[model samples]
Target chain A: MSDANEAANEPIAVIRTPISLDYHYSAGQSASRFLRAIAQGKLLGQKCPVDGRVYFPSRGACPQHGVTFGDEVVELSDKGTVVTFSIVRVPSENIPLELPYITINVLLDGADTILIHVLDAKLEDVRMGMRVQAVWKPKEEWTTSTANILYFRPIDEPDASYDSYKEHI
Target chain B: MSPTLEKALTAPHKLEYTYKRSLGPVLSPFFTALRDRRILGVKRRDGRVMVPPKEYDPDTSESLDELVEVSDEGVVTSWSWVATPRRQQPLDRPFAYALVKLDGADTAFLHVVDAGDEGNMETGMRVKARWADETTGMITDFVFVPA
Candidate 1:
């Protein structure tokens, strides 16, 4: 390589280009019902006809049994136990949280599957089997999106026994 | 409720990212030349000049480093007309994406030609670089126009 041009001596420019794509997302049958229920401050789950296990925010079918769920909707408690969690230190443009925030896979009561959500608590305090409950935004601010549930916070109850949520992890 | 009768929920989503990248040794100088209204090509082992230069020779896999200045004016070797341009396209109106063999260059490079109408585009038409008002060392610094 020849050092011919004086422009080559200049510092390399770091280009910051923002690319954005806009599109409409359609929430089909089962998800429509789930989103509507959440807007009304309720958690709904569908029971798999074969296994009889309930799935929260159901996608209309059972992955394990390979069968579609019917009208058997189950109302669930917002309180859940953290089956697994991770502390995110890296910054992202979409996430409006501070550094070192905790994200958890929570196993809600009476549901077979887990719901992934943000956990607002001290990093050291976030652990497996930690008892937490959903903190929702005001009623007027409620929308058909999961963003209605701002985040989950720790409750005064004792941590659930490992055996209670062992299978989920 | 029947599945067909139920109105599905729809929401608008925007996926965005601001990618910060360093144009390495080869590309760094290429873009820098564009800022000064200059076009560059890399000299291959056979002395063939490739516009929009690559870091390595495509066929021989040799590391290409000789930067040669090429004329912005070129002849369109091949072209495909776009009836109605979509978002982020070089031209909002109708245009043609052409492989232009710039003067003094051996190979052709793909770029948009803002020819106003598709009928105005041809295989061997002459075109020149239409530089942007503010050049920030980016590929989008210029588009081609009928000269």
Candidate 2:
């Protein structure tokens, strides 16, 4: 709303709407199969033929080219390398994250695009391109979100240099 | 249609968002200042300093770093009357909210103006910040009063 026409402006989008319009309980069907595997102690990603790069958290269509991929739903390695990161000093609501946590964008061995996950390793030693792997909780603690993969950290692979991933930042 | 299928055919829908911001070195200074009870702004190329300062230049995307002080007292740059207030607004009763340029600052911010009735508040009305007795350094800590 404009302060110039401020006095005349009206509030919007507040009312008791109908069942059809009121609450959308679900989206039409999405990547339920990939998500289902996460609950069953596994991680799956889709591979795109056009770019020959695997996508974690499967996209129905290739994000860059828009071609649909169905044949290559495969389990991803627990090991990955941190491509970039940010240390969050403050906490946000319902984030399910511990404060002073570092969120790292990791490029897994099989996938082309990197995915973000919580970093559970020491805060000071955390660096970019440091090799890390998933630390899943005991079988009792799996659920809908990727939080199932407790954290990622350097697993001994040589660190990647800044020149290797300049565009990713 | 049976009553159960009718219920199954319909359910609830919700949209939610969690925006993650990467604080480039410039804006981190601003947020860190907020965490420390101080306010900050960036001096723009056009000589207009902006509050809640942005990291990149408004036009050229240059990294802006000149930090300046802004007074709690400011003029209403622009305003809109809330005849029917919405959820999360400061007041339940009808009110006037305005963008006021603070006394020592070059930019404007939105806040609640405590005018008894909607009829008295005007576009050019002057107001002052009424700080909360208890503050966590968030935007909600201030309510404006008629100056």
Candidate 3:
């Protein structure tokens, strides 16, 4: 026990455990309608009856007024402005992208909320107020998952004015 | 939307964290003993031994270092029957998760017991450790079995 070399030679116990939880996730009424539309290459949002603010991929209720949105579904544009973003340098098993990719919080046009998604562009090219458009996967590969939209990419449109989406950030 | 498609979209999702961690101090030797088909416990201030030893006393928060050997055979103090096993459970078939108080140890250790049937599981039932074919200093190195 007193020998430092002996302690260093001893095998330290290490546990390599991969923990996992598998369950069926039911996307409720609002998300179901949104996913259904997105499968068809359309973005759906719910208009708040009180403030008339549109929530993209709505949670079926307005958080501010706590009012349930009925069939007031509004189609939103795939184009959006990058309000904020981060460069992910670490590798993950789930994300297929290369190292150092940009993940952006986009404020989609006609929607009052932001959608957190990956932006496919050079690291130095991504910026706040940068206009980006959704890049969809092939039609045949579309499913009930938001992953159907591969990622957003910088478009040729002008950068959105700071005052336009200032309240969102 | 069509009535069939209107049903809420449901999909199977699996959340996982795959990582390796070092079993430091007390647990390192405890799990290392399990690899050699032996059970070790920590001696508390009152001399009562705790199986699956902790580095610090739970009540007094005193650092403990005295490691004691305990018998693999023990009595099931309590148990809950698992009629159907989940994907990550130690056993693939039906089993009982029991708190076993090993001989010479005061604290009960939580582990799965393969009693063959739910009807065989009961408080005070004697169980013995069934070692895995290959041991790697992990808790899954052995499971409990009706003695």
> On residues B1-147, what C-alpha lDDT tens digit does candidate 3 reach at each position?
334446778889888897677677888888778767899999999999999899999999999999999999999999999999987788999999999999989999899999889999999999999998976666887899999
Better of 1 and 3 by DockQ: 1
lDDT of 3 at B118: 95
For model 1, what is the C-alpha lDDT against the true structure?
0.88
lDDT of 1 by residue, A1-169 (tens): 1222335446445566668898798998889988988999999999999989989887688989998886668999999999999999999987889998999999999898999999999988999999999999999999898999999999999999999999999
| DockQ value of candidate 1 | 0.54
Cα lDDT computed for each candidate against the true fold:
0.88, 0.68, 0.88
Model 3 misplaced stretches (Cα beyond 4 Å): A1-12, A16-19, B1-5, B17-21
Inter-residue clash pairs, candidate 2: A23-B12, A23-B13, A24-B12, A24-B13, A25-B12, A25-B13, A131-A154, A131-A155, A132-A153
Q: Clash pairs of candidate 1?
A: none
True contacts kept of each: 0.77, 0.14, 0.77
- Model 1 chain B scores worst on lDDT over the 10 consecutive residues at B1-10
| TM-score preference between candidates 1 and 2, better one | 1
Clashes of each: 0, 9, 0
Question: What root-mean-square deviation over C-alphas does model 2 reach?
Answer: 13.2
What lDDT would candidate 3 get against the real structure?
0.88
Mind giving the per-residue lDDT tens digits that candidate 2 earns over B43-111?
Answer: 877778788677778789887878775666668877788888865567888878888877767668877
Specify the CAPRI tier of model 2.
Answer: incorrect
